[model samples]
Target: MKTDSQLQQDVMAELKWEPSVHAAQIGVEVKDGVVTLAGEVSSYTEKLNAERAAQRVQGVKALAVDMTIKLSQLGKRTDADIAGSARNILSWTSSLPTDAVKVLVEGGWLTLSGDVEWQFQRQDAADSVRYLLGVIGVSNQIAIKPSLSATVVKSDIEAALKRRAMADAKTIAVEVKGADVTLTGTVHSWAERDLATRSAWGSAGVRNVVDKMNLV
Candidate 1:
């Protein structure tokens, strides 16, 4: 096995090779298989990319990202320019509501806050912000409001959970009511428990998942 220091070196090399980032401005440190990334980037995408580069390395047991984003470059742009850029981004993606979402830029940092009917739309908003030049970081505080009725949401969650349980063929029981999914019963291992939780997340209209499943 490669030592922690050697893994760190490899991660650094990987970051340096990525075309999207300026590797010199990023710092890498590893201890006991955990990799720590520090420094600053000009955009949110670069910061995300830097962390992803570290995660992809073969020997990384975990990642700790502490990178800062510089928004100063965005300060020079006019409001019209910023709004135009945001509009262009919205036009390129059909998943998000172009008008419902609001963008606020301060010292280059962009904060997006709004309510979207789907989690994918929330993701789309964040993605749009990251693509803009001079954006330091994006705070995605978008709420997920269901386009479907409460009854539909509950039905969807129940159906999804049932399908997942059947597919896994485990002893995990799932109970869904409205936006809440409760997992009960027992599984052979902790991995099964985690799998159940993830399966719940994949279900649409699920506001919150309560895992009550016990590991045997």
Candidate 2:
């Protein structure tokens, strides 16, 4: 395991390497295994990319994002324009249902809320708007309304995991309480952990997914 200082340095280096991020404007701090990002960026997309870059570094257990977006005069867009663009882009996305996601923009921040049947659709709604001009931030409040029963949800998620051939599929325990699913187990890497979590969220009728998975 890397020390806190070493992890901080690696995160900073990673941020600098990512072309989308203005790393010089961002500050990195690490303690224990948590990374806290501070300072400012040119846009919301850059901030998201910086956070993703930090997560790609090894030994990042958690993240605290304190960075803010400071859009240039030319980059600024009115809330109405941002909302209109978000709506137009969302309508263009095939994966998302027509008007299934509602958009709210305030202070250049976009918030999406609605119900979708699967996690991918909800994710698509957010992805469609993140790159829009003048989007300072995004809040995806889209909820999942699974079409399947509780029993079916468990079986379906397990089957999905097996189909993906996750090495720890057997060790990963799946629990469904009402529309909520909880995953508990150990995986070898963040990739596997994310895969397992996605499997749970992919199931029909999974309103919420609780990840109790730990990296081994």
* Cα RMSDs, all models: 5.6, 1.4
Residue 22: error of model 1 in Å?
2.6
Model 1 per-residue lDDT tens digits across residues 50-94: 987886677776679888876564445664566578767866788
Whole-model lDDT values for every prediction:
0.71, 0.90
Off by more than 4 A, model 2 = none
TM-scores for the candidates: 0.66, 0.94
Clashes of each: 1, 2
Q: How far is candidate 1 from the true structure (C-alpha RMSD, Å)?
A: 5.6
**Which has the greatest TM-score?**
2
lDDT by residue (tens digit), candidate 2, 1-216? 899999999999998899998888999998988899999899888988998899898788888999988999989999999999899999999998888999999999899999998888988999889999899988999998757788998999999999999999999999999999999988876788889999998887788899898876
